[model samples]
Target: MSALTIYKREVSSYFAQPTAYAIIVIFLLIVMSLTFTFGGFIPAGDASLASQFFAWHPWVFMFLAPAVGMKLWTDEQRNGTLELLGTFPLSTRSAIIGKFLAAATVWFAALLLTFPIVITVNYLGDPDNGTIISGYLGSFLVCCTFLAITMLVSACTRDQVVCLIVSVAVCFVMVVGGFDPVTTVLSRSVSEGLAEAATAAFVWDHFSTLTRGLFRLQDLIWFGSIIVVCLLGTSAILSAKRS
Candidate 1:
């Protein structure tokens, strides 16, 4: 009935299956390969993990976050557990928060597993550990946002494939909405003030700023608002369905 009960169950469910481990392994391997091979982390010869390493996180997260979250509710529904869980004496809001915390934990663990990269950077030279920490925090927020979006979509569907595709599509738009061309097009069609505001609304704007080690309240608010809104929407969706 308590949020803690649901949180513990949700998190335990992840380890109860091999799927979570597979996702973590795939994420570490691909991210490391890109960091060393394509990202030119070493050849760049820079102490910062900025553009060379964390730069690829949005793309990496676009796929993997959905993989982790696509089943959050879709599987519950498919297995007839959604309704059963609803009758467990907890509010839908508790379920939403518990699920989000659970997903975020998996993501944070996956991020932690990439510490060898951190070790490499430290070994090579004295990099700004503060900046590195901020970058990881920003990436964690990104994962949470994506998971929130995925959870919302999963709440809307019982088919995991549909949930995955919709979540990916939404996440993709959020990522690309910050690109130069997209911003340019919006600026041309909309009033300059509105266009600028719209472009700033994209994930890339705030996320990139944090990656650069600049901690602004505005950036934190942007991600915080998205996380809260999406998770709330998820709760609403489940509540409506239950009623």
Candidate 2:
């Protein structure tokens, strides 16, 4: 039928399963607790929410995002529903876009559930709403990028566990590319340009900028490009299967 119909169906499928709710609840609890405890939101003597919220994103997404996205296509393929989906009247591109948007919506809901932290920050001290907004934007973009990567990997296999593991491995490298420990080691052995390029390829560098309330066009482009490339690759794979 229509793209919206597919989108609704996919979104409904996720909500119908208790696993999605469990994942969201568990992820939120872990992130919120870590942000308050390790990130020093309360003990750092600073009212800024940056440390508490943004600090945990890379690590949290390392597992949670992939867990959410691992089933996108893999489950369909496992159930032999993907081929049936192909027989529908909608174009492959529309189906892909619809499914992607549905997954993004689930992620958006997970992000939205963290608003209590936003409220707590606002209540405690003068935090910049602008910066918090930008942080959310950047975090959501990173989630989209991770989800797109997971979707691509999910499309490649019928086993959700395999999809999850592959997605996690891919996402881990991207996250580590921006980590200080990894970058420092790289800078020692490689040129500064190579090190910087590695950092630039991941979500950390761009996300850090956004968390600081600076929304650079290049950062936006980097995240957007990754999503586009992954989704296109996924579409190509599916199209080949149809042929």
Write down the lDDT that model 1 would get.
0.89
Using all chains and alpha carbons, the TM-scores for the candidates as numbered come to 0.94, 0.96
Pick by lDDT: which candidate is best? 1
Candidate 2 — which residues are off by over 4 angstroms? none
lDDT of each: 0.89, 0.86
Candidate 2 lDDT (Cα, whole model)? Answer: 0.86
Candidate 1 residue-wise lDDT, 14-69, digit = tens = 98998789999999988989988989988899877988888888888999999999
Q: Which digits, one per residue and each the tens of the lDDT, describe model 2 over residues 150-241?
A: 99998898899999999999999989888888888889988788888888887789888898899899999999899999999999987776
Listed per candidate, the RMSD to the true structure in angstroms reads: 1.7, 1.2
Which one is best on TM-score?
A: 2
